[model samples]
Target: MSSPSANASEVLIVSARNGPIAKLTRDEAEQLFLGRRTTLSDGTPVALIDLPAGPVRDRFYLLLTGKNPIQTRAYWSRQVFTGRAQPPREAPSAEQAGNWIATTPGAIGYLPADHADSRLQALLPLR
Candidate 1:
């Protein structure tokens, strides 16, 4: 029953427990999520995962990029049409996104605070 305007203050950007990334600034996270950057400042390639098109996904994009779901869709459409980049792989839900991030090396994704657990290393708090 989430909505695009759901309170996202509890969202967290996360990675695998052993991921090379220890932390990320909001600018770096925004760049990575928007497909503007592929590697961390230290050059570790990032495998970004995203939640499927939904309230959580929309809320994340809105908070991270200040773009609504429709705007984000258009942005990605252009990126794809221009061959600039593909959007991150989509997970079925926040819990699944967290699971993937925890098990995949160099993987990063955002999840609701409750879903983030010991398997994942939280890099940044969206709020």
Candidate 2:
């Protein structure tokens, strides 16, 4: 039988090959996505890319930030209206997100595990 963690769905946080980031803890990822952190561990400026609203997007935010979709939208709206931060760039699908992360310097995005590949470096796994 599989363990709970083994069975749990996971979203892979990925970056471009040769990007300054190596890996991120879940808390660090949360901070980045929440606009609380803007750079990678090596002090490289990074951009956040998000998958369009759907199961993978939902699961990634819920598991990493403990925020549901509605709450997340509200949070970003407040930040944007206050001129504090902009929401992440969004890709229309997992494939697009993966491709963006793979080719863009300092770009980071989450994808369902099966879409992860050598083109991108997996930084964190959020369940």
Model 2 regions more than 4 Å off: 1-8
* Clashing residue pairs for model 1: none
lDDT of 1 by residue, 2-110 (tens): 3344354567788888677777888888998888888888788889999888877788888899999889999999987888887899998777887788888889898
TM-score per prediction, in order, is 0.88, 0.88
Residue 122, candidate 1: alpha-carbon lDDT = 72
The candidate 1 region of ten consecutive residues with least summed lDDT is 1-10
Off by over 4 Å in 1: 1-9
Give per-residue lDDT, candidate 1, residue 19: 71
RMSD of each: 4.6, 3.4
Tens-digit per-residue lDDT, 64-83, candidate 2 = 88999999889888988988
Q: Report, for every candidate in turn, its global Cα lDDT versus the true structure.
A: 0.81, 0.80
